[model samples]
Target: MANFFTTALFPVMNQYFGMPVTFLIHGVICLVYFFFVKTSVPETKGKSLEEIEKLLQKG
Candidate 1:
């Protein structure tokens, strides 16, 4: 959304900068995704389906 608006609102943005604002936003998003996966995204660290269901019900 921010990228789209940035490009659309500033007509010369793509011409002057190349690869539209979306490219920069995409790069940032990719960096964040890599960082998140490296630091936070869990590795399916859970138990069986039945156990998960039981815990969900208790919660």
Candidate 2:
């Protein structure tokens, strides 16, 4: 998925913004994505599968 976006957008981004700006934009995008997932996803690191299933089922 990341590869797909990189391949599809790299040319357009590079053409418009050049390599440095393109990389900065990608970094910012990744940071935003990281925070979005961090906040919205539940942590199940120590939980059993059954407990995880119940958590999701509650939602």
Candidate 3:
């Protein structure tokens, strides 16, 4: 599913924005995703199912 969008959008973005700009855009997107996961997702390492569920339910 992700590949489908990447294949479709990459060429158009590259054509209009050029390679460097396209990569910078992707970099910004990755930074946004990093922050979102860092803040919004819970850490589940060594945690039990019940604990994880409680964290999600609290949200």
Candidate 4:
């Protein structure tokens, strides 16, 4: 999926926005994705296996 998008969409973006802007757009997208996952995902860093299972069952 990523390869297809890069091969197909990248050229169109680069043509209109140039390589720098295209890269910046990708960077901003990555940052937004990072924050989205960070805030929306659950953390199980210190959880035991049973605790994790319970959390999953609740959800």
Candidate 5:
């Protein structure tokens, strides 16, 4: 669904902003999304399943 929407919208975005601006817009959006996910997600390296389950259950 998202792919289709982006595919359809890319032409309109490119038409108004041109290819270079469109690519820059996408790159910025990807970087922002990456940072948001990286900060918001929890890290559970080497944690046991029971410990992970307890952590999730607390929420």
Candidate 6:
């Protein structure tokens, strides 16, 4: 998704704002997705599948 937006969407946005804006937009997107994944993605390090299932159910 990120790569698709960067390589595909960014170019379309660039037509309106130019290449530098496209670069900045893509950079910001990458930064946001990086933090979003880092914070929201669970570790799942040692938890069992049943444990995860219960956790999901609770939410």
Task: Indicate which candidate wins on lDDT.
Answer: 2
Ordering by TM-score: 3, 2, 4, 5, 6, 1
Which lDDT values do the candidates have, in the order given? 0.66, 0.93, 0.88, 0.87, 0.85, 0.80
**Residues 4-24 of candidate 5: C-alpha lDDT, one tens digit per residue:** 867888999999999999989
TM-scores for every candidate against the unseen true structure: 0.37, 0.84, 0.86, 0.68, 0.68, 0.61
Give the Cα RMSD of candidate 3. 1.5
Candidate 5 — what's its lDDT?
Answer: 0.85
Model 2: lDDT equals: 0.93
Q: Name the lDDT value of residue 16 in candidate 1.
A: 67
Candidates ranked, most accurate by lDDT first:
2, 3, 4, 5, 6, 1
TM-score of 5: 0.68
| Candidate 4 local Cα displacement, residue 50, angstroms | 3.6
lDDT value, residue 56 of candidate 6: 71
* lDDT per residue (tens digit) for residues 1-59 in model 2: 98799889999999999999999999998998899989988899999999999998987
Candidate 6 ranges with C-alpha deviation above 4 Å: 45-59
Better of 2 and 6 by TM-score: 2
Q: Candidate 5: minimum summed lDDT over ten consecutive residues — where?
A: 1-10
Worst 10 residues of 1 by lDDT: 5-14
Pick by lDDT: 1 or 6, better one: 6
Model 6, span 1-59: residue lDDT tens: 65665677766898999988888877887789889989887666799999888877776
Off by more than 4 A, model 3: 1-4
**Residue 7 lDDT, candidate 2, scale 0-100:** 85
Error of 1 at 28 (Å): 0.3
RMSD per model, one decimal: 6.0, 1.3, 1.5, 2.4, 2.4, 2.4
Q: Best TM-score goes to which candidate?
A: 3
Give RMSD (Å) of candidate 1 vs. truth.
Answer: 6.0
The TM-score between candidate 3 and the true structure equals 0.86
